[model samples]
Target: MPAFPRHVSRKNEYRILSAMLLLLHLAVWWDFGSSKSRSLLLAHAGVFLIWQPFWRLEKRFGLKDTVLFSLVSIGLACWIFFCWFVVLIGLMSGFPGYRRSGRLVYMPILFFLVSDLLIGCVPHIFHVKALPPAVTTMFQYGLLAVPAWVFIVRPHPGGGASLYSVDLLRAISASMMTGMLAVASIAITYHLGVDYPVALFQSLLGLALFLFIISWLLSPRMGFIGLAQLWERSLMNIGTPFEQWLAELAKLADQQQSPEQFFEVSFN
Candidate 1:
């Protein structure tokens, strides 16, 4: 009946959730031991604060629209810098107001593919030292699951269940599939052997390129479809004169005496 949950007041909920997120980010920064990882966690935190449903500090503090927008934009940029794939999974998982698919059964399959083809698989491809099995597992699932829980599981102020039971099942399935793939890839690569930094450079470089291309394709303004269309048009000979010729051809086809004549005129 109430717009917001009567059980927990909005301000209290925001404070509690924000505190939990801050603690979790710090724990991750301590555990991951990477500057980029810490930056990524900060970005996720930024998105969480400005994400509307999860928190209301913006409205409570009387923040301007431009300020809020800037926060969200910066958060997004940080995610892009850290791992574009995680950003994609967050988008695919859900947001506060938008409706997504009923079942993302294929998401797990996609995760394994991306990890194999783009992430962990690269190290193996180049015979890199690769992370320890435990570390690799953490990177594969723990790293990704945190963001999924935040963006996909956490409910907004007025929003209902972030995911149905079935949706949770799909996320679980994806995680399991990724775990299996990581194990298999590591086993195969371990037997083949690595050449230290030589392989590391190769893997990291290839992965960087892969992420860049994927990020460009996923861009809202100029995605792969836009790029493809531009490429096609560039190679096409169509111009004003070509358009006029096509119009005249259509006119001649309309005036044809029969279907056969129409075909002949169009071909000519």
Candidate 2:
């Protein structure tokens, strides 16, 4: 149970905090902009930077580092695309190393990324009209409340980064896979002559079914070994030696006189 230095009793407050800020930003700033919108976006980036995983806030930054940070954060906000913004933020969550980051952190991060791409990005690709202001407003601000209820009721004592260790391969894979799923769904429907909103719905339904099947394969509820467990066991518990052990057990049985004696000697 590794813990972040900032919070030895780390509750993963930063992970959720950054995620919320990202969502809040996207709720309003859905398109590329300049001036006031860009300013607001920079402000949002500031909040995330405080808890960003790429570098430690506890350490001092030099002039070069400061400039680089400003350029990336400000540049991203100034040319902001809601879909891309959330995707990048969600991608950064993988920096803490997936193997080390617990389900609490990883699950929410995945939810944030996948949801943004599907709900916010997919239709935009096909130039669909925006949702009505009222519906958009409701969703942008309040949609996350429902899912947040399923996560983090209490501040558990562990499960945040102890140190920043970016797993580059993992970070790319998670983002690309999630993005690809969304794109592939839309691509399939579009090629089949499906229209915008309907295409969106159908694509989502197909994606959901795919995800359900994958989840079941990883860990089925039926009385049998799951693929995840079976893979792990294969790596750790190779069964070839069991054959030799069985042979030795049989040889020991013949060395004893009666069944009772064999049983006693073998047991010992």
Candidate 3:
């Protein structure tokens, strides 16, 4: 079977690392006071930290049937950091039986119903604005939900025709961690008297860099098939020399050799 080569040159690796560091430095000095600049920086870092790694992992593992990992990664990162409601909607829609005939059609309707109730009716009961801040946020996330279904519902790429549970779990776990850290950082910064925009930008950039480092360290040292072969050779089979010794012992046993002969054969 053909596989994408895992051969990345040292020079290329160094270049990528250097560029990332440069971007980090530039982001550090960017005017975080401006909402536009902060958003732009977050988007850039999201592409680098989430999109790039996800694409590489998808290619390396051959995990998905569609070319939508990029969209999935972007949507997931945005939802984790900015939109909790979208994640809830995804979890609600991603269960195993939801993909059955007649059910898939209703998932979106259910999502919209719940969203509208939360954004419209609940606020009406509270006598708040008809369109509150939370509703606007949910509306924004509802747009993001379109791309997320591709990630949650796609079949596995390899022979196993199921969802890529490992990849999905990893992504979700990392997203949750990133979200928690970002919130903690922002809260701590707020307590320390840092401005909201700067605190947010700094916290997000720090979380991205931390995730990058963790992924770099935890990435496989060898190709998946190569690692499998290594495991088979080192674990399943003893060695050529041991196989030869076993062959000799079998010969001795077949020949009706005496105990003395078996001992000689075993020692030699």
Top-TM-score structure, candidate number: 2
Show the lowest summed lDDT stretch of 10 residues, model 3. Answer: 156-165
Misplaced by over 4 Å in model 3 are: 1-168, 220-268
Model 1, span 9-98: residue lDDT tens: 333433333343434344343434356554555565544444334343334434475577568555543223224334323443432224
On lDDT, who's better, 1 or 2?
A: 2
List TM-scores for all candidates, in order.
Answer: 0.28, 0.54, 0.27
- Candidate 2, 1-268: lDDT as tens digits: 1223555224555545555556444544466354554565566665555555555545566788778877876566322454555456446555554453355555655665555545555455455544456755665666465346424444334544445466665667666656666666667665876654466566667768987877777775754465777656655664547656777789988897799987887778
Best by lDDT: 2
Pick out the ten consecutive residues of candidate 1 with the lowest summed lDDT.
100-109
* Ranking of all candidate structures by their TM-score, best first: 2, 1, 3
Pick by TM-score: 1 or 3, better one: 1
Give the C-alpha miss distance for residue 128 in model 1, angstroms. Answer: 11
RMSD of each: 16.9, 12.5, 20.4
lDDT of 3 by residue, 1-268 (tens): 1233323321133233233323322332233224543454355454343223224422543345334545554444322324433343333343334235224432553444344333422332333333445645556455344334422443322311122132354335544654464455447554776644456457667778987765555456633555545545655565656787788888877775588777776676
lDDT of 2 at 59: 59
- What TM-score quantifies how close candidate 2 is to the native fold? 0.54
lDDT scores of the candidates, listed in order: 0.45, 0.57, 0.42
